[model samples]
Target: MIQQSLVLTGKQKLAWLENEVRDLKDDELLICTIAGAISIGAELPQYNETDVTDCNPVYPRETGYESYGQIIRMGKEVTGFAEGDRVLAFYGHKNLGVVKANKTVKVPDDVEYRYALLNTLSCDAAKGVLKLQPQRDDKVLVTGAGTIGLLTVHFLKNYMNVKHIDVLEPNDKRRELAHELGASHTYSKKEQISSTYYDYGLECSASKDAFHSVLNSMKHHGEVCILSDGNKDLFYLTEDFYEKELKIVASSDGWDYQKHSQWFFKETVKVPQLSKIFEAEITSDQLIHCFEELSESHNKPLKVLVRYL
Candidate 1:
């Protein structure tokens, strides 16, 4: 079948190109339409074609991941899932494709496809939250109010039940959204935090500066969990690091599927507002224009869902 997929050929421009896909294998499942995420400004560093060298710095020449789709066809070996089942997978932004059965998880019938598309991110946030292990009364500061940051805030408040939650975000829209998501206080920057110290800090901004800000705000022997991935190097003064006896840890995409499933089910019930963060939904045909619009918009979109149908 002829399938359309969105490929990032340049820095921020996406091309909706068509290609042919083969039939599903016995151990594979055929996915129909789904939603995927764009990592243009996050993982992909902006650069001109003139800068290309033997380095080939870009790890993924084509970008896009985090997809959830309906199972149009299932292989004979697939036991848990059937045809027409809604499943979430680590697939790209392709309109149709075959994915190994083990890599896909069936989404609950009650959950929306957009919300299911966030399965990977939600899992990542849950893993980070689990690692932080914040106490109920701890004053927790979450840096960055982006999707992951806000999701971390939601999990901290709802899942962990951490009462004193604060968020630091430069964007006004995101800061406000953080407030609505259960942050007790919100600041435009770390310097604006009224509290002198926090028991724990969840650094989600992926900015080296933000990481340092959180580290500086930590109390003696305080813990800070780094959640975002960035290219910049982080440096801390020897005196400050020793004086505070700070502990820092990093969390990333590796999440146990069983734990993720449990967290997803529980958190989704407690925080239905989690799905509200997605601001825009565009079809595959509008992929290029959507990225352009998002690149130009100053307000900053929280989560933009690319729909394929």
Candidate 2:
């Protein structure tokens, strides 16, 4: 079967595109190798409008703003990514793209695909965790225990010296996973947030109410690192921002590495911080669920790495 990069104007139409890599380059390696496949998450929210203009309006830019699987294909040509390398791409959904070489990062062979996909999430975590560095024995609160939030737990506990890492998760199973993943404490968003000792707050959950929770529960002059992608228009965030004097930094893909032009025999590059945030690398043998499994997912570790087993 030939492989085609599937695109949908809306997510409900995704059922038709699922598993539909029907147009291929006919190269045995293209089918056999992991080159053509990519990873993705965050399906089009079903209830939301399909047009997705405002609220989720084109992020990076029109047409190119699509995240998840879109980036894998969008960055294919411009980024000098060499074909055949195991790339850790954040282009969303289960891998579907025609990406260029440089746009992708090389995944070490020992890393699992699930973990490699998890690595893309670490970009923001790297930023958040770095903020609390030299740890100061300061208590930390992470308001969301999903993949990214839980991943943050792994980073803070294993890598940093923070006095405590508290997690806020509504999902029971995910809460268990957070503890297993090394969270010092966990709470449901429904429960009242305690300002016992936390000096830093990382809001990975995009829940509208959680933003206020981040501010209300934080200690005086505490740092609030928001890693979600949403409009500040969700509510008036300015007053508390000014009143609490909180350093509320919006980290919705704000990182852009400026590199020197590549010249023969010389290259200047700013490496991504995947290893610091991702749980670990994954190999092709660990490929689990495919595109379909990820799209319709309700509760599953949608995190994955795409490669031929």
Candidate 3:
């Protein structure tokens, strides 16, 4: 079987690679993708070649991890899932791929493919939220209005019943979207955050300044859960972190996909507009062009959803 994939040939470079698919392992499922999502925080740095987390850049690498598809074939050992069942997996932006049966989550029939793509990040947000264990009355602050940040806000306000959820973001459009998504306040500058004290904070901006801002806004001994990939820059401990004796915990990927899906899939129905987080939608064929547009500063969208046939 031949598969076409989006590959990063070099900095600001993209190409389609046609390759042969390997035989499916007994524990794997063959998925025919319906759509995928580009995580701006995680992938953009690599795409723009600003990611310094690695000593050097590696070319001809795959670039995405969020995708939803139907199971075209399932291994005999796979029991819970079957052929034609829709699921969300960690596969990249491609028409078809093989994924481990355990790592995939079954998408509810009522959930749209575009919305199901969020399963991964939403689970990540839920993990971070669960780590901190914020209460309904606890004032929480989220730094960044990206998909992860906004999802953090959405989970806090809607699911967790957090009353005062404030967001800090530099972009006007994102800040406004944050407000619509149930943020009590949106601040673009640090000055606006002077008097606010939060019981907990979730850092999703992956910006050094934003990380520090989250630390600075916390109350004494306040806890913080970092959801950002932080690929482009290193985060250092700030004075507030030391002085306040803050507790910071970092989380990446979902803690439990199957368990979280039970709650998230149902939540999607109640919050139908939550899919609005994806401001732009493109077909799988436009992936290269989509990344090209994303490389530009002015072309930033909350998130881009890629639809595949």
For each candidate in turn, the TM-score is 0.87, 0.64, 0.95
lDDT of 3 by residue, 1-309 (tens): 788888889888888888888888889999998889888778888888787686588777887999898999888888898799999888797888899999889997878987788878888998999999999999999999989998898889877999999999988988988898799999998778953399999999888888888888999999999888878669999889889999999887788988988888888888776788888888988988888888886658788888887
Clashing pairs in 1: none
Task: Provide the lowest-lDDT 10-residue window in model 2.
Answer: 260-269
lDDT of 2 by residue, 151-223 (tens): 5776676557465888877877667777766677788764556743468888876766777777777776778
Error of 2 at 84 (Å): 4.9
Please list the C-alpha lDDT of all candidates, in the order they appear.
Answer: 0.74, 0.49, 0.87
Task: Assess the local accuracy of residue 83 in candidate 3 as a C-alpha lDDT between 0 and 100.
Answer: 93
The number of residue pairs in model 1 that clash at the backbone is 0
Per-residue lDDT for 31-116 in model 1, tens only?
88666765433533332222222235452355466777888888888888888988877767788767899888788888777666
lDDT of 2 at 268: 9
Please tell me which model should have the higher TM-score, number 1 or number 2: 1
Show where candidate 3 strays beyond 4 Å.
none
Against the true structure, candidate 1 reaches a TM-score of: 0.87
